[model samples]
Target: MDLNLRHAILSNISDNDQSQLEATIVDAIQSGEEKMLPGLGVLFELIWQQSNEQEKQEMIEALEQGVKSATAGS
Candidate 1:
């Protein structure tokens, strides 16, 4: 079977409102299920594509800090 996960994921959330999207993200993260990772990646891709340069830089910094913190705690 040929599956386009990104397209499927995007279609699922395309009509979400702000609160709905926030809840979807929060729920996915809190669930801590590996299967949710791809969906989160797709969401991040959408955000990255739409963000301005400064926003992208901010995201990169935040991600770097998160990675550092995660590794530090381990």
Candidate 2:
């Protein structure tokens, strides 16, 4: 997603009553629902915005490792 939309979503997360939204995300993940991934993309975007370059690099490395692990398992 584009940075502007990411910022907008993060702004909404900051400004809105987020408890329900957060619950929904948690529920989706716990249910092992692939549909919830788009919601997770919002989370990833927010994390990206809040992180510095070094932190982002670390996060990406972690994500890459996770992906490799998952793919290997599959």
Candidate 3:
């Protein structure tokens, strides 16, 4: 059984307005619930799929720096 979680998530939110999408993302992130992680991952996947090389590089650098900062803090 190949369950398509990302497809389901995207279908669920595809009709949302910009403000709704913003709220969904903000609430999901702020709640820090494990359940929200998959939704966030789907959002990130969509963003990655849409981004060009420069944007992707910037994202990668930010993620690297963020991990470094977090590890340092820990």
Could you tell which candidate, 2 or 3, scores higher by lDDT?
3
Worst 10-residue lDDT window for candidate 2 reads: 8-17
Q: What TM-score fits each model?
A: 0.91, 0.62, 0.87
Off by over 4 Å in 3: none
Candidate 3 lDDT over 1-74, as tens digits, reads 12598778989999999999999999998999999999998888888999999999999999999999989957
Q: Per model, state how many residue pairs clash.
A: 0, 0, 0
lDDT of 1 by residue, 1-74 (tens): 12588889989998999999999999999999988999989888889999999999999999999999999957
Give me the candidate number with maximum lDDT.
Answer: 1
Candidate 2 local Cα displacement, residue 35, angstroms? 1.9
lDDT of 2 by residue, 1-74 (tens): 66786676667567555786777667778999886676679987667999999999999999999899989957
Model 2 off-target regions past 4 Å?
1-26
Candidate 2 global lDDT: 0.77
Instruction: Tell me how far the alpha carbon of residue 47 in candidate 2 is from the true structure, in angstroms, after superposition.
Output: 0.8
Better of 1 and 3 by lDDT: 1
